[model samples]
Every structure is written in C-alpha cells, then in structure tokens.
Target: MIKHHPSETLLAQYCSAQLPASLSVAVSIHVDMCPVCQAKVAQLEAENAKEVFSESQLSSSTVKNSHDTEEVDFGTDLLNLITADPSIDEVYEVEPVTIQVNEHNYELPRALTRISHGRFTQVGKLARSRVAIDDGPLRSSLLHIGAGGEIPEHTHTGFEVTLLLDGEFSDEEGSYVPGDFIWQDGSHQHTPLTKNGCLCFTVVSSALHFNKGLSKLLNPIGNLIY
Candidate 1:
C-alpha cells in the first residue's frame, strides 16, 4: 500500500548510476521494498541496454550473430549494472543487525545492516537518535522518531531524502509508511510528526535550517548539529 515514490527522473538517475552513493543507497532500499519501483527500474535498464547496443559499431552480420544470444547477454549485463558488487548478497547473509534505542532493538533494512553501528547521538526528550554516516560531501543519518514525537518546523539548506523503514509518519506533504521515499529541498518546510513511531534512513546534502519559533534560534548552529 505504498503510495509515495521517488520521481521517475530520480529512478532514471538511479538506473544510470548518476546519484550520490548515499542517495543511491536510499533509492535502492526503497526499490527493494517496492515491487512497482523494482519493475520500473528493470524496464529502464532494459531500454537503456537496447539503446546502448543499438548504437554499437558492430557489423550487421556480427549484430545478427549476437542477436541469437542477445537475451542471455542482456540479462547478464542488466544484473551487473543493477548489482555492481557481487559481495552485497554475502554481506546481507553475514548476520542479523539491529539498532538499539534504550531497551528496544530495531532491525535495520538489509541495505543498512552493515552501517547501523556508526556513531549514534541521542536528541531531544523523545527516544530519538541520529546515526551519522560519513559520506564525504553528502551527509546521511539513521533517524528514529519515537511515538507521538514531533520535530520542530524546519527547511533544508540543500536537498534531503528520507526513506521510511518502519512504522509511519506524516508531515505537510502526507503520511508515509514503510518504503515511502520522501524528497525535499530548501523551498520546503514542515514539522514531521509520528504517531506510532518510525525508523527512517535519511540523506541530506547540507544541514537543516530551522524556520520557526524557538527552533529558529538554532539556525546559527544548525549546520554543525544537523
């Protein structure tokens, strides 16, 4: 019942390997959970391969010969493109990984299991914690919002992407469930609220810029904290 999805352009970029590693990871996790997106990406890859091979410099006879084995070759090429690293499956099978918040342990998404152990910093009175991922210029984090918790109204300094992994949450945009991918930028501002708590994988190019009430005062230090 996932309604929200990454835009088609974003999916195209993902298929072409044009996104940042962090953004790509977020989209990959979403694509894994969403069969619709999965099919869409597969179709895009198929079309891309078709266009690529059509423009090849192979002789007409050579192309005709390859046509006999084109299906198998296309499948192999698509597999390699979608999964650039063969070790990803092995990593998933390594162990069960979880992120601990107080007495509770939440299982992370398969794409995130390996990196859940990074530094986790608690925030606010709610059971929220931010786990920072070192992605060079692109800042990413694991954001856990406790039940009934609400984040202060804020806008982004740059682009932001949030992929819900567990539970549900809502904002000015709409309610988002697991597998829903939310993309926002500097022009957008909203206070995210969770009724039954949620775990989200998020990536931000820059820090957030608070835009309301007492939270606005944090603007001076938002870049450092976010």
Candidate 2:
C-alpha cells in the first residue's frame, strides 16, 4: 500500500469544514490517498457532529495581506490551531519528495479544463482560486499543478487546502495520490515535482505569500491575466 501522508490532524480539520477552502482542499486530497489520514478525518467529522465547527480552525482574515504583512510574521503558525480527540491515536504522514507515478492524470483530463481555463484579466492563468465569502477576502484556490510541474516553496498568509484530482505529490507533509486531500496551517513549505508527469488538483485559501522571487517567472504569460 502507499505510505502515510503529510498530516492527519490538518486533514481532519479540513473535512469537518474547519479549515479554509484552499488549504482544506489540499489536505483533503492527501487523506483520500492515505487511509491513516482518512480515518482521522472520519473521527474528526463524527466529533464535530456533536460539537460546533471551530472558528479558530481557519483564520483566513488574520493572514495579513501585502498591507498588513508587517504586522503578521506570516511564518511559523502556518497551520491552523486544532483540538484532536485523544481516542484517535493516528500519526500524521510525513511529506514526500517525489510524487507517485500513475497515481492519476489531470494532464489528460478535459473536465478539469473548465477550472484551468478560467483566468482573471490581470491574474492570467489562475494558479490559485478562492471561495467567495462575504467581502472579507476569505479565499480559496484550485491550483493547476501541471504534469512534471514543481510548485515553489512558499509560506501561507493564512491556511491552505489541496485536493489531488489526478496524479500524486509529496512534500515535507507526505505523499498524496489522486483523491487525496491535504490541510496545512501556516507552517508548511515544500517544493513539489511530479515524477512521471501528471496533473494535480489543489485548493488554497489566503493565497500563499510567496517569499521567493519566482512569481514573475512562474506566471509569465499568465501573470495576472486570470
């Protein structure tokens, strides 16, 4: 069987609708592939059935945009704060370096074109997307990680959610195959590269405040066009 995934608690929080859409989708894909993470998600969901959804689970507004970047360190505390039940003793999966081949293929999928094709006039090809919440800027994204693509290492201004519709990926978190979901608070940074080349689905909130200067090169033609 495939190895465990990046984090279990993070994924659990996402499925329970505790994390932001962006990060929630990421963690979700991870859990889909790793049974360990899935189990934790199930447990968390059951608990939430009795308990109210945690507000602290995903604090998107606190991420601090370019204007507030100074006030927020935007480092560490990347992951959201969560309370896991003691009964669920599963361990979080470690991030993976090389993604699994043949895990899935968004590269060849046409249905996904609907999402990938959408671009903002300035944003160009949207590498990220967000859920529309009141005018609060609480956003999320479905990243178009291309085959053999490598997403740069960036820290979160808020939370990040990723879902692997096709292909497999891994980072400091762990390996994620298709159907896998991952959740990350603020403290996550990893460069992901596909092995055999495949497409990946991801959702992220509080757009990653990229520390690296590759933004220009990363987007190039698609920059802000989306």
Question: Which of the numbered candidates is closest to the native, going by highest TM-score?
Answer: 1
Cα deviation at 109, candidate 2, in Å, is 13
lDDT for each candidate structure? 0.79, 0.49
Candidate 2: clashing residue pairs, number: 56
Where does candidate 2 stray beyond 4 Å?
1-34, 37-136, 170-175, 213-226
For model 1, the stretches where C-alpha displacement exceeds 4 angstroms are: 54-94, 125-134
lDDT of 1 by residue, 1-226 (tens): 8988999998999999998778888998999999999999999999987776664422222322355554333444545655987766653254667767645578877777666445556676244344445678787777778888888999898988888888899998888889999888988999899998888888888888988889888889978876
Q: Would you estimate the TM-scores of all the predictions?
A: 0.79, 0.44
Candidate 2 per-residue lDDT, tens place, 115-146, comes to 32332122332244332332244443345544
